[model samples]
Target: MDGLNDYRRARVAEILADFTTLQFYIAAAPVDPPNQEDYYTEGWRALRQCAVDGQHILNTGADTHVPITKGGLEEQSKAELQQVHLDALGRRHQGQKIYLRQAAAQRWIELRNGILQGKKPAAEHQASLQACDEQLWLELAQITDEGIYADLQAADIQMGRWTGEDPSLRAVQRWIRSRR
Candidate 1:
């Protein structure tokens, strides 16, 4: 009985140590835009592992008395950390959306000019415009934040008006607006 209890306690301690390491990694993850998705994925994985290990420790029935909040393993702390990761992801996506919007606008102008000057057929111009619209919609879809999604929807509506591309643009606008 004594040995079994000792083994359980040791196991709990080991799991807690691993959980703490994951916590540190999550807290210190870089916010670089290019690698933001990878960082967020790693942070989310670590958070999930910590939660699983914490549950396992609780199930062991060992003489574990660690206070989660004080030790930086509390549920509230995890929630706060997850929020930080989410906000970082939102910022990165927002920056990407801005860049894509500008590029799409420039491309639309060039395509329209080509069509008007007979450098390209109207059908070719329309196809190019449709591709650009699709790319912008895809970029917007990658963002998960509701506020950012709403902002992108408004921007897309404006872009549609400026480019005089109504049908496909209106479809994208409706889809984005309907998303929660």
Candidate 2:
């Protein structure tokens, strides 16, 4: 049991390190072309892999001779591991927001420059700008959803009950107040 616990801890540490690397990659990703899909794709892949690995550890520990108290501790650790993933998702979502905003701003600038240079902005440019706006809204919706999910998970951890309320309402209100 002790050996299994040690192995689980080591595996958790490795997953956390991988998550940290993924966060850094997400943060440093470029907003412009020659766009790199590999970075985003690989980061997501690594995150999902970490999740699978954590689940595997939990399942394996359950099958082992882990003591009752130790098993409870492992369960708590698993919850905390889930929180880490939620936090990573939040960070990645923010990074995507930044990238989308930058891309939109760049497109608008290009459109303005073209007008100033006596060239009508291409229809494709207009379409691209609109697409960026739509994408931003979609990303924002996803971020909000992730935040709500994280809040629910947090409530479950802290209160041990799943209350199906809109956890992000207060956060949204606070943001609105700050903007005002």
The best candidate in terms of lDDT? 2
User: How does each model score on TM-score?
Assistant: 0.26, 0.32
lDDT of 2 at 78: 49
List of clashing residue pairs for candidate 2: none
Question: In TM-score terms, which candidate is top?
Answer: 2
Where does candidate 1 stray beyond 4 Å?
Answer: 1-70, 73-80, 118-180
Alpha-carbon lDDT of model 2: 0.40
Question: What is the C-alpha lDDT profile of model 2 across 28-131, one tens digit per residue?
Answer: 54333222332243223333343443333323311122223445666655444433433333333333333343444344444444543544436755665455
Cα-based lDDT at residue 39, candidate 1: 33
Worst 10 residues of 1 by lDDT: 161-170
Candidate 2 lDDT at 115 equals 40
